[model samples]
Target: MRFIIQRDHLVQSVQDVMKAVTSRTTIPILTGIKIVATEEGVTLTGSDSDISIESFIPKEEDDKEIVEIKQPGAIVLQARFFSEMVKKLPSDFVEIEVQNHLQTVIRSGNSEFDLIGLDAEEYPQLPQIEEENVFRIPTDLLKAMIRQTSFAVSTSETRPILTGVNWKVENNELYCIATDSHRLALRKAKIEMETPANYNVVIPGKSLNELSKILADNNEQIEIVITENQVLFKAKHLLFFSRLLEGNYPDTSRLIPNESKTEIVLHTKEFLHAIDRASLLAREGKNNVVKFSTIGDGVLEISSNTPEVGKVVEELKGVSVDGEELKISFSAKYMMDALKAIEGNEIKILFTGAMRPFVIYPINDDSTLQLILPVRTY
Candidate 1:
């Protein structure tokens, strides 16, 4: 196998594929990246059983040559060394040649490295998804959905299902919901489906995090294909596959309050800033809890007190404060996370009661919501 590739393109592809490569895989070949050079272009694949990423660099993009293949073949090389070597190569171009017995030579301006390569035949084959269902979403929308919801996935392993984001598609809309029992974030966006799809699948949070990073912020549409046990996301020239979590995700509908006992409309940044400041003191406290209270007419006061440290008092003038006045305490970290996810000038906070869970969402929009369970302060 012999090919000459632009270093810039090769480096970017290597970084994307390396996200799925793990050093501790039980299969020895999984630690290596498989490179296949063909007449059309070059394909780079890396996997660790749970997730796989394939990056393709075309021989010519828009009439510009990115790669030139002398002999079409495939080889698997150690990802750790090969990926680093490409980045540090002395020139803007890279040449790779595989000889008999899997001897590989990588050369650049004034630098030459010889690596022992493995037969690409030993690498596990990427799953060929028949794709009974496929949906298309704008790249920007997909990245926003991931950022808005994936953060709330449970980090605990006690309930393995909560560690994944619940993806649901129905009525031409896609909804992603994630919760760690204490806080939940849900984002919804309209999608066009080739056929109507009603799939409720739980995808591991880790996988979505990697996918979000791989995607660029552009108008390009990403195609999502779902089978029974796996999901594939095709973005630009890359293909990402992840194994779906096995268990059923818990129904989160009942958790969101139907109505609110107290509601407040406040500027998003102002509220976020108050909570961020109040959190400093809360961080020194036992539970990192901050208190919120509605005062006469229009004042909202946020306070945090720690016996060992000090107290913080920050007030914000709300755009409008209505409903029954109430006081509630919740994790400062959770509030900040929720506030960051909401996009807009103003935000609405709905509280069921002092003890019941409350929801934070952008005003005048029903698409995104963040729910938080208040912490008891005794």
Candidate 2:
């Protein structure tokens, strides 16, 4: 493949594709990034068996020539070296050419380098998705859904299914849920559908995190396609595919309580900051536990104690407090994570009891909810 392309466009596309490339794959070729040059444009792809990302750059966009193709062909280059070389190139444009016997040449301004290239034919074919069961969502909304839930997924491999986020669609609403047994996050959005979509799939949290970073905050609609074991997210000129997690996710409906013994409405940032500060002491504790107690008169006290690190206490005045007085202990880290996921100024917390799980949500919105299991204090 021979092409001269703008360095900026090429750098961005290569970086996006590299998100899927990993050096630890069983297949050696999977470590390289595949580049193909055609009359239309240049395509770059990367895969690590579980996820594949493809980025395309057209020859001309907005009446400007972004790529000039001298020869149409394909090659696989070492991702580590190629990515670094492309970034450090001291020119606005770069020329890449594939010579005889898998030899590759890269040139920019006053610098040039020759590198070994692998046969593109060796790269595995991406799963063929027919785009049959397809749905569309706003790019920003999709990113938010991922951000609000992906963090709560378990990192352990013991329960492989728990390492993925559950996506369920019913009655034109898509609900994203993630939990690590100790804490859970849930977000729901109403989506207009052409036909009823009844897909319940689990996607790895790592895949969703990469997708969220690649997606932009725009009004464009992102097309999603789901097959038996794969899910595709298509946005503009980018395509992302991830393998679906096998096995059914545990039903979490029974975990949310219908009644609460205590309820408090407070500023999100204020509560998060208090927990963050108190966590300094909690770091010295075994469980990193922080305690919250209702002191009446719309006041909530957050405190943490460590025999070695000293004790820290902070009181927060909320908008309102109701129900019975309660004191609960929970993971300081978990509480901070949930608060960061909740994108609102005001937060409403519902506590069932001192020892029971509690649910938190935005006071003005019911679309997202977070639940945390209290830590036992002995």
lDDT per residue for candidate 2 within 68-169, as digits (tens), equals: 999999999999999999999999999999999999999999999999999999999999999666788999999999999999999999999999999998
TM per candidate = 0.99, 0.98
Candidate 1 has its poorest 10 consecutive residues by lDDT at 279-288
Candidate 1's error at 260, in angstroms? 0.9
Tell me the tens digit of each residue's lDDT in model 1 across 80-121: 999999999999999999999999999999999999999999
The superposed Cα distance between candidate 1 and the true structure at residue 85, in angstroms, equals 0.4
Q: Return the lDDT, model 1, position 38.
A: 99
Best by TM-score: 1
- Clash numbers, per candidate: 0, 0
* Model 1 lDDT, residue 112, Cα: 96
